[model samples]
Target chain A: MLSFTFWDILSNLLLAARWTVLLSLIAFVCGGVVGLLVLLARVSRSAVLRKLSGYYIEAFQGTPLLMQLFLIFFGLPLVGIEVTAWLAAVLALTLFTSAFLAEIWRGCVEAVPRGQWEASESLGMTYFEQMRHVVLPQALRISIPPTVGFSVQVIKGTALTSIIGFVEVTRAGTMITNATFQPFLVYGLVALIYFVLCFPLSFYAKRLERRLHVAR
Target chain B: MAYSFDFSAVFDYSDVLLQGILMTVQLTAVGTVFGVGLGIVGAAVMTSRSRILRVIVSAYVELIRNTPFLVQLFFIFFGLPALGFRLSAWEAASLAMVINLGAYSTEIIRAGIEATPKGQIEAGLSLGMNRVQVFRHIIISPAMQRIWPALSSQIVIVMLGSAVCSQIAAEELTYAANFIQSRNFRAFESYFVTTILYLALAIALRFVLKMVGNHMFKRRSHA
Candidate 1:
């Protein structure tokens, strides 16, 4: 076993944490884009579109994220689509986050009181126009807390990317632990780093939830 | 570069996959039962009048909630063994699941308990019931009923989360897939089968839990 000081282990783990943050950003942003499209499809008037999006959501949500990561990382290469660990990790995380976020934002959009839609319709507004002007504006407010909350999940979920060999905080900790044979020290720091990353989001989510509740 | 799919390799290993499925189901079942019990206690403690107990429960909840389960599992599986507390992979996985599930269950059950009306508690007390009696008769039963859906969903999440046990070589369904893929180099077919099995298991678990809840809380059927 390598003799490592506290600072040595921490510095390595911190470097790895950058990947965690980056992966979370990539996944969250990409998932947000895809999820918005999914939300739109879900709420669209076309039955086929809605059903397809519904199926997509159920498929991702019903299955394990670990399984999804495995399928992308290992399974894709077999079919001639060569993917690096980074590609597979980001793709899996994005796909998983999109399903949940789409559901969340859909609930938000649906929660915009029925009368608001009726009012927009009365003004001869198109569905897109109504959503852009009347429905989404209100929905955005209600969506903030849960969206932030879901982002925390997204951040935590990025840890699973480690299994695909994307060297994030958790993966780095694993490596360090193996090298140093200090599982407690290494993993404790890992958990602490994750706590630092996640707690603020949890606090902010709670604050937003309270504000949203009071606003209503 | 086009490659043809060969699923027969995976099909031939169906028995191994079945074993993995059974283990996953067993892990989920044991974990959910114990986890919910811990959750109820945690929730009760958090909701109790004792200030220190509330703080302890809140701290436990926050700590577990903020950390990833993979890390938590590593702490148990890898960390504890180094501390001279060697547990098998199955024990480590189940313990981690119990801890994770307990935290989530605490939150859900606490919500349910809080939703219990003051009048009902008062009525129970006025009928000469002690605190424990009132708690069991009026609070916990109704709280379980009120939170059954959320609790069941959390349990399903636990079932899915069990996939992480493969990292520790727990030989669960995902681990079986990993093994088969490594052996056969048929990754797509292996994981595809695993995913279908997981979906089927999740659906089955939800159905069974729904029936169990229905039978257990018949008095609150309207709930």
Candidate 2:
């Protein structure tokens, strides 16, 4: 077996970390877009939309993301559809993130007091107009910390995509460990890189939370 | 062209799936007990007066919380052997799970601990309860009572998360699905059954925990 230097392993893992970051960003952005729609549906006056979003959240959040990925990865091929690991991972993570982000945002939107809603209605605002002018603005401020906090979850979650043959940092670490027989060193470095990516967001989330409490 | 779905291959291996479900439930039971025990200790350390302990606890929480559980599992199962200690797949999986739950529950339980009003602790002290007694009797129950819902949900999350332990060949439910699929070549059917099993487990766990919380959260006289 050829020996890999410390730098060789670290550099290889760092390159793979790019995919990790990219996957997280794509999933986060996509999930955020879908999550907003779910949030709107959840708060809409239509019982069907509200209940539909509720089931959407429960289905995604209630199950493990690993199974979700596996289902998409294996199940799609049965219908004569082949999916690359990248596409499968994106599908799974986006659905998973949407459920969580929607729920978090829903909590914030609901936190806007009843008086605000009544006042908006009295001002001859339509449902969309009331949400746009009054409710969403107030909710946006409190929602930031939790939304940022959930982003850390999104980043960490991208690691599961590794199981489906995606060569993100975790998979790369496993591959390198196979090559170098240094699981401790390789996996330790992998964990550290994830921490580097997640900690700042987590810290900022906490700061935002504290600020929210003070504002309240 | 239409392909018909086949689940008969998976149902033929019902025994294996049953074994997998039992193993998963057993792992979660052991995991929940030890994990919650460790979380109580970690939370206590976090809140204790020692600056060194506070630093160590926060660092432990951050490091675990920020990283993925799968990597942590790999590190324990594959790494620790090189460091002189060897762990079986079951041990490694359980340890990984316990460690994961401990980190999460520490912060959760600490939030519960912190939510205890200062006057309550002082009241226990004035009643001549020792610090240990105060912590065990006065603090733990109400604190647990308050956070029972969050703690139970965390337990269920960990239960669901335990599916990843199958990656290490722990013979959990997901592992059974993999094994059955390999034998029958019915990958979709196998995983579909396994996924439904997990969803059922999560829902069942939530239901049971809600019942448990009802009993635990009942108001009792502080006296």
Q: How well is each residue in A1-216 modelled by candidate 2, as lDDT tens digits? A: 678999999999999999999999999999999999999999999999999999999888777889999999998887888899999999899989999999999999999999999999999999999999999999999999999999999998999999999999999999999899899899999999999999999999999899889988
List residue ranges in candidate 1 displaced over 4 A.
none
Clashing pairs in 1: none
Error of 1 at A201 (Å): 0.7
Q: Candidate 2 — which pairs collide?
A: none
- Scanning candidate 1 chain A in windows of ten residues, the lowest lDDT window is A73-82
Q: Give the CAPRI rating of model 2.
A: high
Candidate 1 structure quality by residue, lDDT tens digits, A105-134: 999998988999999999999999998999
- lDDT, residue A215, candidate 1: 78
Model 1, position B117: C-alpha lDDT score: 94
Q: Point out the worst 10-residue segment of candidate 2 chain B by lDDT.
A: B214-223
Q: Scored by CA lDDT, what does every candidate get? A: 0.92, 0.92
lDDT of 1: 0.92
